[model samples]
Target: MLDAHLTTQLKAYLEKVTQPIEIVASLDGSAKSAELNELLEEIAALSERISLVRRDDNERRPSFAINRVGSDVGVRFAGIPMGHEFTSLVLALLQVGGHPSKTAADVIEQVKNIEGDYHFETYFSLSCQNCPDVVQALNLMSVLNPNIQHVAIDGALYQDEVDARQVMSVPTVYLNGEVFGQGRMSLEQVLAKLDTGAGAREAEKLKNKEAFDMLVVGGGPAGSAAAIYAARKGIRTGVAAERFGGQVLDTMAIENFISIGYTEGPKLATALEQHVKDYDVDVMNLQRAERLLPAAESGGLIEVQLANGATLKSKTVILSTGARWRQMGVPGEDQYRNKGVAYCPHCDGPLFKGKRVAVIGGGNSGVEAAIDLAGITSHVTLIEFDSKLRADEVLQRKLHSLPNVDIIVSAQSTEVLGDGQKVNGLVYEDRVNGEVRRVELEGIFVQIGLLPNTEWLKGTLELSPRGEIVIDERGRTSLPGVFAAGDATTVPYKQIVIAMGAGSTAALSAFDHLMRLPVAAKPELVAA
Candidate 1:
């Protein structure tokens, strides 16, 4: 079950169904199958137009086929639709119940005109917040065209298939038995891959010597802001990123972005990309910067070599490469990463609602996560490696005020304890007593410090001891014509608002540097 509020919302949403929709579930009386059947029955009870039909088919025991009353659009889900993916089931029902899709006209037309039979097998985890987007997109495409079929496979339930495919991550899409992608992908990106024979063109190189006046080397909130600010100056601006939404994509709920009372990471990321597209910023996705080199000619250009064997020359480069969460390097951590071990509390916390969970690390982030989870989960256990928590006094006071939170100091996490399916407990050492203990919990949230993505700039730019790029107040790096911002720099705090402000400052500094250059040395302004 859904809560009262969520049930009311789903009821209202399901009331719009004008045509009958049937959910045919194949079950074999297994535990997961029983859970899935109950979920389907509960959902089907919401509307008079919806019905659930259970078949005792051992071959596809845990699979469900969604079919419209009059049509034979093949859409199947082979897992329990819980957690964030519950939205996918609802959307699929609405799509099958005679509601027109909200996809773009061009995209719908393209989907309708596909020639060959394309089978998309999208492997996903229930806890993954980003998997629903890809699943919904593929399901919609399948509904639009009979030639295109999509099967949503739960990576946890079907371990044999997942291991056979070597799927180490959630949302691993396979097209015609080959790996298409590994993470969140947009509908347009998937369409592009379908158009071209290549699965997903994530690392394609530039065709010619692309140039820009201001080039941003990331695509998080910082890089998006920098590109928008630079484009406002009516100069040639370009942004290269491994993905359009850096760490933001991995995040879940984002309530700290000022003025925006509530929003999710993927929603904010989509808005950021749309805002950047509104300007003249040349965005190159799936391009990773490998090496940074100054041009042979003095005061000429900076060359950014990409992993795809393409080089980009720019007058100024703003480094906004974000940081990644530090891992505990414990056993079973990698094996059950998306299953029960998660780095993002905002993203995966809801999956453990009303269940016991533990937060690793007692700093600001760990305390914040514990506070946030206390209201949702049944219990919160905060474990710290240090003698005392390093969080601010205000945060500590607030954390202590919660009744459901328990703190353990000087506890060194040794290993993650999990069954072959998912995490069940955690093992840690009591530093003060020199004893090892296991804490029984269903989920573990790691809120350790971040590791800057500045390994490529080690010898090129001056970095701090923690490998963060050193930058002045004006965002200027030690190397001339190079600037750094956001988590990749020596910034004190790594917040979204702070990163956006830093990005704006870096863009202004680059503009000021360009304005001071001689007429011959200045970059040419291309028409927007």
Candidate 2:
């Protein structure tokens, strides 16, 4: 089932495996088992260093054990490793096959020192872009410490366990049968959790209490870029975010970030954080900004109230909270979310390659997603609620040029259909004929619109009708010292390159604002 291009890439990657790795597949008489067996066989054929063994086990059918040729690291997968989980499989094989772990030395030391017997059960969805990082981290840690065992579970395949655990989101990790984390977590964070035997709540306490000259809110590409730029100017820079990556974590492939030809969302996010850390930016993760109080007087300090009951003082604030994909809110949409219903095509499209898929909405995003998926997926059905598509003429024409794409207009998506496991089809209403129809497909991509992350700024900052913060050419808001960038602003297009540029503009504007202040009134620059 591997494409020629992907096959080549796999061969090159597998060449780095110095030690032999074995994949022991426990199979039952099920289609999911067959699919996984086929995938494993294909991967094994890529290199002689890898081997696949099958066993007819009834208890854990469709599960697999990944073992180094001689050493057993106790790494296992309870479901088909497709979508984002596919990366986990690749990385696990590499790690077990003698590839050195990339985790930092400090984190490795912490993992080595972890005392008690801990079994990490990470429940993830095939479509979740952030799941692989958490899974891979745990898997690597398991290899490093014999006391730690890691089991990666596909939530879609194990609905019973998911329901029992009340797992509402992907990348939900459990340590010793208790909730550990809900989203993407760095190795340091995981180690800290293991060391402290506490959850993220313990780490939310604000450490740096001093004032900052430039405080960038949000930690997406824009905010990270702004923080980096501001810190380079030798100013007191700080960044506060609920999570570092923001919506970038949900994104999959990124080929449009100028100069960089190819990269993934997680890779870019790591680079963004590292770049910010390279400077003196005070990064406060897991901290949400609840309220923003503009300075009463020009050049006065601004107060930012966080959800954790911590108030931060800053000379200037740049808002770059970014935006999230709009949901359909149809029946089964939420229930089967991340199962087969996904919001990001770039992240999950590869999982559905050679499978039938449907795209909701016919705007630029939807049409573009359809066009992009047509190259990987066997076929794509684009559904539009209006009589005609709302995408740009150029994009519509480009979409029509694809042979594997079908356009359906005047159609309203009514519900997502699943077989209690994963998405199997989508139900839509034919508005023109008043008929409801179900399209047989394995996945559904929703691309209706993006809701900016400026809801908290409502009634405080000057906002547009669409709830985006109103900004001038210099990325300045109506408030003198406050600025905004990225999708949270009135920018026309929402792209990574555009957001980075906007971030730089906002940082420059903030710096300009800071430079105009009197030396006695300016906040002292503290070395990060």
Candidate 3:
């Protein structure tokens, strides 16, 4: 009768409860028996207060993992999470609210010290799989904490962004808004900076301000030439480019460029870059211009907008955007590029010294490359899609006079043969035989004409059917105050000397346009 009455009263009390119940106690655990007795008393009280605690008896329940054995608290120590310690700690933390596993502890320690935002901008090309590690590290740091942000930029997709940042190498990470560290760095090194709070302080110190004057759009021969001239004229200049040396960087050797007749393309590019460094020019590497717009009325400034949202305002703008090698668009053409297949004989021909190499296409460029390669390599095979070489008679004569040079008429490259990584050789089909034959070679040069890089300017500027920018002799484009030079423009012959001359002409014309602008518009004309 007494128990039934008590149960009834308890049910009535439970029905009246509306708020969360709380229990607070500080038990002395120093004495073993006393601590156990206290814990038991607390547990008994908890069971009476909670129906769920009272319902469970022998089977493992919610508090089993946390329950102390005797009067001691169950604790574990970890030195290193080398083997299974890391996994064990992580699983324990996930399973119950105890000590974190060794691995989890280490991971926490690794990223816990990061107190401020870290912004990393890295460049990577499709060809570089090694950059994935860098991307993963930065991403891991970002995910582990809130104060870190990592951005992995594709070199090709964000060409303009890369150009604006002047990225020359892959895995170039910029912290906050300024360049932090470069190349492949270890996780420990990165952690050390975060742990010491140096990176956070450094990030806080960076200031956003305009630091450049005139930013030349390209870094081809013409662009470099223009930058050199502009810097020498006492103008603060910046050169933004996807690649510092431009397309010429891929060339192996140049025997035709005046003054320096015999030099590797990469070497020449390096020299040019060094020369620019000698001046006050701010060379921004690996940037691409996404848009060009007139700046707001700030004295006399013209702005070049990059894909990265960075803008360069200059008093004078010189566009020396160059052209790229025209691909055959054949089955294996792209697959073989820079492998057994090549675009510039001057760049890759030396690699085939004492070996066979094929020069594709029948135009003057093809004939010229074949003639040049024949002198350096042991054997040269000239494969032309057309029935005859379309070069000038003198070039044709020069090509035919070479004893080791074999001219294969009416032959077209059908397939480039090799693994996905590198080209081994190529398969060509003869118009007469309708049969295909493979030619083994150390390398192949695609000497077809280049395609102008003017697709972005399609509606904005006048372009020929071939897509070259149409400009006057003075390098002025159809649009007012716009000028173009180098291979992108409607220049007849594409050569270093010619591009340099055209760049000089364009720079002078741009200067003239800037001078004509009103004094109030000068700032707008010159902000970079």
Q: Write the per-residue lDDT of candidate 1 for residues 148-232, one digit (tens) a residue.
A: 8889988768877765665646687888888888667877668867776332333343647467899999999999999999999
lDDT scores in order = 0.85, 0.84, 0.61
Q: Can you write out model 2's per-residue Cα lDDT over 114-229, one digit (the tens) per residue?
A: 88898899887776778888899899988888898998988767777766665646677898888888767867668766665433343344534788999999999899989988
**For candidate 3, what is the lDDT?**
0.61
Clashing pairs in 1: none
RMSD in Å for all candidates: 6.4, 6.6, 23.6
TM-score of each: 0.73, 0.72, 0.53
Ranking by lDDT: 1, 2, 3
Question: Over the full model, what C-alpha lDDT does candidate 2 score relative to the true structure?
Answer: 0.84
The best candidate in terms of TM-score? 1
How does model 1 score by TM-score? 0.73
